[model samples]
Target: MTSAPKPISAIDLFCGAGGLSLGLKQAGIEVAAGFDFDESCRFPYEANIGARFVHADIAEVTAEHLEEIWDGAETRLLAGCAPCQPFSSHRRGADTSEESNWSLLEHFGRLVNETKPEFVTMENVVRLMRMPVFEQFVQGLEELGYTVDYRTVNGPLFGLAQTRRRLILVASRQGEINVPKGLGNGPATTVRDIISGLPVLENGQSDPTDPLHRARSLSPLNLKRMRASKPGGTWRDWPEALLAACHRKPSGQSFQSFYSRMEWDRPAPTITTQAYNFGTGRFGHPDQDRSLTLREAAMLQGFPVDYQFVPTGSKPTLSKVGKLIGNAVPPAFGRAVGQTFIRALAQSIEQGEPT
Candidate 1:
């Protein structure tokens, strides 16, 4: 009888709260370790995922360190989704010339070359395609003899409730590889699809049973504004008296997404670090007079309902927890990518080739 295929192992760099690790584990890949510079991530990442969490910057990580983490696995995989703020659409007109995170992609490329892993993957904002650093990273991979393929993907198409667009790249030393087309399952996930069943709370009220379900208290005037707002409607629909001075200006007239309530039937706008604040983006809840709670934001990001964001006795601050949720790769999308990696590896094994 033929032997079963050996399991592939991976190490995630810039792993925040272990979202990718969770999804990859669900897809049958063994995540050996996760490394990130954020110290706040240690509690949640270690609590929920099986991988060991290393609190160190990626630039300081060496191939020897990674090989030590990999232990003895022959099918080594290195995955990194470096911070993409420098290449995000939000920085379009701003001075991003000195952004500290700009060189992280280059650092990622260096590790890939040094480690010489058989399989590699990277996820970043779609705007990354426009940057010169992105070109250099791809060229570096090619020079290392990797066949790379990448494309922009919509999160909702792959079962995430948030409307996030990201660039996904896959590389293989064994042969050419491609990102799998999204499964495009049944109906698109909606805001209500994930958050409808959570316990209801008044504006600024938190469910005592779940600390992460706490919503920030809105100011009286903002409460009134939220009451007047309708699902999928913008601040433009509000009365003249409640409008901000900036909104009255021509420049602000185009910022329609601010102070807007999410429609129940459609996927939510991308969840950002400020998603818990009503004034940031279209974060207000439909029919509720407050923005999305931390738990709700995590749900929209495809994190499991029971996923731990902070340890016991540690206060669950919105800023700290929101960053973890907002920056995570949707677990569903990660699962799809993990499955694709497995297929590529299996194909190589069948042909008696190394991957």
Candidate 2:
């Protein structure tokens, strides 16, 4: 009699609040364990993902440890979305290659070379594509006899309610695999589609039932600015006096997306770590005179409405939560990733066999 195939499992590196883990679970993949340096992620990852979460710096993680955590799953996946600040477009023109923290990508590459998991995946800011490190990672995988492919995908194309563009890479030692291209279907998801139903809140008001729905307080001057700000409109729409000194300068003209409002019919702008701050990007509400609520930011990032990022009663600090949400890979995109891997695995002739 033929033996049953061993189930596929994944070890998530830099798994923030378990977004990728949750999506993998949603796609029927077993998330064996998650690793990150943040202790705050333990509860949410374990609670929601029902998987083991190890709070440790990726720099300290070893391939042996990751394999041990794999627990003998015949088909294993190693996935990571290393912190991207060093490679972010915002820091362009300044060389960040020598920073010790940027070595996190090197660590990820080392683990892949050592562990040689059946599947490997990575996600990061699109700007990473231009970096030599990205070329090294892709070439290293190919040298290991793995078929590798990568692409830049827009969030809305993959069911996200925002327009985040990211670079996604997938490698398989078993067989040829491809990245999932979001089909340009009918209408893309929009802000109203995601957050229109939440209970309304004024600036500085919190929902009694769900504190995550609270909006950040806006100053009087900014409040008037928001009121005058049209959805998808720029800061130039404001009265000349309301414009910041920077806005008066020609250099600031290109920064029009800041302090604007999201259109109800379109996907939200990329959710940044400061998404709750009105002055950052087009985070203001479509009709309300305030910036996005915490929950709204999560929704735009493709997290569920009730997704838990903190302990039941522990306070959810806005900046921390924003960072967590902003740094997360959208669950919708994660689901697509999980689905694509599963599809490729099914056709993989290796089938966890000794090659």
Candidate 3:
């Protein structure tokens, strides 16, 4: 009889909605715990991930906590993707202010230094490279004797239908860890592929039954504005009477994607926290009257069709659910990173090298 392979374990920090943990579980890794500061996230993280959620600041997490959870595991991984809004290009690099929110990455480094986990991984917007702090992070890992590899990746090329690009980093004390290779030149998945079959609704409609599948309310003026907008159509296509005051302004003239409809054949625009508003971004459905639904946004973020996010009585507003989906790392993207780590671990075991 053959023996089973050794088990792998990981602890996830900033584990919003448990996207990364779900992916790690898909890759056969046991999640030790999910750590986050948001008490609101605790129920969802624990319910979906089947792991403990530590609803405290990461700064309060001690080495003993990590050791206690990782006990009896052959390999330990410390994984996190610090909040990326501070480094996002959409915000035009204004996230450089020394605000408390900007220090999550530094906190991640502290956790690594204190616990000395065998493996470390992180994912964020590619714009993070523009900051000097990223270099400091790399140097800190190197100082701790870790072989680190990182690169920018396009999510659509790796099974996600959204045009999401991210910076992923993996480091190991056992040997070198490389970024997942892109599956070159395949056809991009489109909006229709992700949400073609769901029941349709109007601009301000809900399923009446499936509360989680509801759309945000639209104002009377906005409803007329959306009706005039067709798939892939811009504000230029809207009737003059329905145009918003900003649309007529010289400063707002350049923003074309607003109040625009999505193309059925094209990958979706980046899902944002306000994706249900036709005027917010390119969130309108290709052939439908309304903006993208909450379920559609979740699907584009690579959540499974049945993945439960919100609970009973709590209405799934576009802004709230969009924030959850937009903030999450796609599970497929995490699986790709996990596979890379698996290969690196195997190589280290074979060659007697440090990971």
lDDT per residue for candidate 2 within 145-233, as digits (tens), equals 99999999998888888889999999998788999998578699999999999988888898887877889999999999999999999
How far in Å is the alpha carbon of 57 misplaced in model 1?
Answer: 1.7
| Candidate 1 stretches greater than 4 Å from native | 85-100, 353-355
What's the lDDT of the predicted structure labeled candidate 1?
A: 0.86
Winning model by lDDT: 1
In the range 182-232, model 3's lDDT, one tens digit per residue, is 677888888888888788887678877666566667788877777888787
Cα error, candidate 1, residue 137 (Å)? 1.1
Question: Which pairs clash in model 3?
Answer: 172-355, 173-355, 174-354, 174-355, 175-354, 175-355
Model 2 residue pairs with clashes: none
The lDDT per prediction is 0.86, 0.85, 0.80
lDDT of 2: 0.85
Per-candidate clashes, comma-separated: 0, 0, 6
Pitting candidate 2 against candidate 3, the one with the higher lDDT is 2
> What TM-score number comes out for model 2?
0.93
In model 3, which range of ten residues has the least summed lDDT?
A: 85-94
Candidate 1 residue-wise lDDT, 1-355, digit = tens = 2245688889999888888888888888889999888888898888999679998877678989999999889887888688875332333364558444467777789999898998898989888888888889899999999999999999888988888999999999978689867875779989989999999889989898899998799999899889989899999789989998889999998889898899999999999988999898999998778889999999999987899988876679889899889998888777988898888887777777433
